[model samples]
Target: MRVAVAEDGALFRQGLVLLLEAAGHEVVACEAGGDPLVAQLSTIPADVALLDIRMPPEPDGGLVTAERLRDAHPDMGLLFLSHYAESHYLMRILEIGTDRIGYRLKEKVGSVDVLSDTLTRIADGEIVIEPELAKRLVERPRSEKRDLVASLSERERDVLKLMAEGRSNNGIASTLFVSAKAVEKHVANIFDKLGLHADTSAHHRRVQAVLTYLRSQRGDA
Candidate 1:
């Protein structure tokens, strides 16, 4: 896939370019800040654009740029490469849009396999959230006495967390050392318990389940 990158740190930007090249992806544009990248995208074509969540001139400049890019290039994939896993950041990224978008930690996404998977998922219009961020959101303490998530079993919660991380059933099964059929059963149980009917497609239900998981973190459901 063709990719454009916007990062202020010269060393990290160059390393990211090298990593993308090593993965056999074309690096079309590399800019030092969000503004330049936004300008470049007007003329250059890229399949995916990776932006640092925090960049120069403004603390959240990358996010600002992402919103603009989303408006201008609705089909292009956008991924935020951040060093922090703060809920506020994830919330902001989700506000931008869930489809063809992702937020991943810089430290963890350095792995070639993880980076490749994340980019591919984003390109395929999946919401690719960092697993660490998903875990933190899922494990955070909730103050609500009557919680819907509390009704879930331990294993169902595990499957739900992976679902929030945008893992396929096969991937979740691989991670949890279970068969795909078992993963499907757990996902079905989660949907039923969460009151998600089977009227929708399984993919739509999966997305709804993940959104439910996110809503629970804020005591909204």
Candidate 2:
């Protein structure tokens, strides 16, 4: 596969290039920042674009570039590499409505096979989420429900899981085989029961829920 990498850190960028090239994929272009990458995009049609979530000029410049690239080439696969898997970042990528999107943590980059598999999956039009993220997505709401799960309806707990997974109301409906309106009511109930309705971004809510969940799991262990 033809790939392009956009990352501001020289060492990390070079290490990625080495990894991808050694794995037998062509590294068509590598850029230090997003602007050069945007310029390079005009000349090169990449099969998959690997981008760092944080880049120069802005913290989310890579996300901005990904959005632009998606607009210009809707079919192109895009993968975001980050040190931390922020819920807001995942939410923004999903908002783009592209099936060929992936979110991976940098620590996992040590495994060439994993990285290659992720790239191939994205290229094949599958959404590839890291296992840790997936675990967090499932566990987040269960933790929040510890004090209230007994009182809350089963549907409310389901809604909370889907929300932590960064699903929209429509997504939760489809997944749960319920109507969007029903999902909406469940989400509202969840917020009310959990007291998570005020003074927090959706990003913060999801992160907090996931962290709480993970901590609980550790305590259980």
Candidate 3:
């Protein structure tokens, strides 16, 4: 797939370009700053654009670039790459309502195959959320005396615990000795129990929920 990567770090940007190129994907454009990225994307259209959540000039400049691109070229897939998987940052991108969006952690960039597959999936109209984000979604509280997991069955809770540990649906299935479809169903149920509507953008809420859970756990200690 043809991709354009916009990151503030020079070394990281170059590293991404090299990784993508090595994986037999085209890196049409790599920019270290948001201005150059915006200007470049104005002329060079790509199948996917991977942007950092925080870029120079403004901490949220990359998000601005993403919004602009979504407004101008709705067909192009946008992916947010970040060091910290803050739920609010992911939510802001989903509010744009563009399909084929992705949110991945920067640490996962070590695997070119996974990155390539995620880019392809995002371009092909899949949400392509990271497992970490999915875990956060499972921990949120939806109602009085009911955390997100309260509505889940025993099987669903097991799936959610695995998800929090960064297991994919297939991985969860393998561990539970069930089919992938069962894992998917459990995930869907978890989403429903959490009151995460059909907005196609729940990454931020997931992060927030996880943060809240972690803080509470620490406080209890």
Candidate 4:
């Protein structure tokens, strides 16, 4: 796949270019900030661009840049690269409203094969979310709880917290030291309380619950 990378650090930019090339993918452009990327975006035949959350002038300039680029190049897939797991950044990125996108920690780029596969998946119109964001969702403080989460009872809230963490019924049961049957009941109750019954898709309910949880934390929902 053809790729473009936008990162502020010179070493990291070159390293990413090299890594993509070594993995048998083309690196069309490796820019330091959003302006250069916008200048080159239309002309370059790149499939996806990996943007860092912090770049040029301010810390979250890239988020705005991604929004602009998404409007200009809706077909182009975008991936956000972050230094640490910040759920607020993920929530803000989602607000820009683009699909075929992803948010992952810089630490996730450890393996060449994984990076190559991730780029391929994103370019193929997939939403590749990082697991860290899931954990970050549930780890949010109680003072941050909003209407959606505030409505849930304590046990149901515990289930929702683990659910946002991507824990399975069995996994949550083990964590809570409850029976799997009890965990199943909790999961159903969670879906009911969150009003997530509309979708029959395999992961729709889970995704909705988690996004709601995170958006509540960001105070956007």
Candidate 5:
């Protein structure tokens, strides 16, 4: 895949470029800040653009750039890399829209496999959230008044977690050592328990289920 990178740290940016190259992906454009990336976007035909959650020009400059990219190219895939997976950042990412988007920890994404997989998933129009961040969100305390996630069985919750990681039913089945039919059942149960019965595409419903699960647990950490 063709990739563009925007990061302030020189060494980290170079290292990321090397990692992308090692993973057999092309780094079409590399910039030290979000502005530069935005300026060069017209010329760079990147399948996926990787941005640092925190960068120069401003603290949330990367997010600012992402907003511009969304306005200019709504369908472009965006993958945000952060040293820490803060809930606030995830919320902001969600606000920017969940389609063809991703948020991953820098340390975890350093692995060639992880980086490549994330880009591929984003390019395929999946919401690729960091697994660690998903775990942290699930572990957050639930409120008694509106706890849809609490209605799910343990196995269903497991399925939901993998869904947040952007895994397909087959992938979840393989991970949980269950048949694909069982995984499908669990996913259906999760959607039902979450009250996602509106007429919509399966992909839209899946995204809604994940958003509901995460928002239900979003609170003071």
Candidate 6:
């Protein structure tokens, strides 16, 4: 795969280039800041753009760049690297749609395999949010947020939370230590309760379920 990267820290930027290149992906372009990345986008062709969500111009510079990239080149794949997986960041990412995008904590970059997998997954059109961000979105104080999400049982909510985290059934199963069959049943129940019967694509339904779960928990806050 071809990749472009934009990170303000020189050491991290160089390390990233090494990692991607060593993993058999070409690093076609590397920039020290978001603005430079945008300026070079027309000239750089890449399958995925790995970006840091905070940088020189603003704390949210990478996100701004990602949004601009989405507008300027809708087909571009995006994977964000952040110090913290805050809900606000994820919200903006989801606004770009739950496909061909991902969010991973900066700490995860230390693991070459995970970082490579995240980029590959995003390039292949998947919503891959880090676990911490998914937890926040799914486990917000239910006492205040329950009304809208009350239809789901506690276990069902657990399953849906992992689902929203972009986990496949097996992934959710491993996280919750439940059988894949049980996870499948929970997903079916979630779909029925949340009215995700719009189409046959489980991927689409999972995205819709996740959006519903996040929106409900984030209601008017």
- Which one is best on lDDT? 1
Reference-based TM-score of each model: 0.89, 0.66, 0.73, 0.73, 0.92, 0.85
**lDDT per model, in order?**
0.86, 0.74, 0.72, 0.74, 0.84, 0.81
* Residue clash pairs of candidate 4: none
Question: Which has the higher TM-score value, candidate number 3 or candidate number 4?
Answer: 3
**Pick by lDDT: 2 or 5, better one:** 5
User: Better model by TM-score, 4 or 6?
Assistant: 6
What digit string (tens of lDDT, one per residue) describes model 6 on residues 77-184? Answer: 998888788877788888876899998888776777887878877877888989777877666644655554577899988887778778789888988898999999
Report per-prediction Cα RMSD to one decimal: 2.1, 8.8, 6.0, 5.3, 2.2, 2.8
Q: Write model 4 residue lDDT over 1-221, tens digit each, in one string.
A: 88888899888888788888889888888889987887888788778889988996376868877887888888888888888767677777767753567778877876798687678767866566676666556555346464555677788777776666445576679888999999888777767765667565545556666676567666677
Q: lDDT: which is higher, 4 or 5?
A: 5
lDDT string, candidate 1, 44-97, tens digits: 999899999889649888899999999999999999998887777877787798
> Candidate order by TM-score, highest to lowest?
5, 1, 6, 3, 4, 2
Model 3 Cα lDDT, one tens digit per residue, 3-34: 99889888888888888998888988888867
Candidate 3 vs candidate 6: the TM-score winner is 6
Comparing 1 with 2 on TM-score, the higher-scoring candidate is 1
Give Cα distance to truth, residue 22, candidate 6, Å: 2.7
What is the Cα-based lDDT of residue 72 in candidate 5? 79
lDDT of 1 at 64: 95
lDDT of 5 by residue, 103-221 (tens): 99888887888788889889988888889888767655367414776777889878877998878888899999999999988888877877767568888878776776677666532
Q: Model 5, which residues run further than 4 Å from truth?
A: 145-148, 219-221
Against the true structure, candidate 2 reaches a TM-score of 0.66
Off by over 4 Å in 1: 145-147, 196-200, 219-221
What does candidate 1 score in Cα RMSD to the true structure?
Answer: 2.1
lDDT of 2 by residue, 90-152 (tens): 667766643788888987866679788788868976666666675465545345456665566
What is the lDDT, from 0 to 100, of the residue 83 in candidate 2? 91
TM-score of 5: 0.92
Per-candidate clashes come to 0, 0, 1, 0, 0, 0
Model 1 Cα displacement at 28 (Å)? 0.4
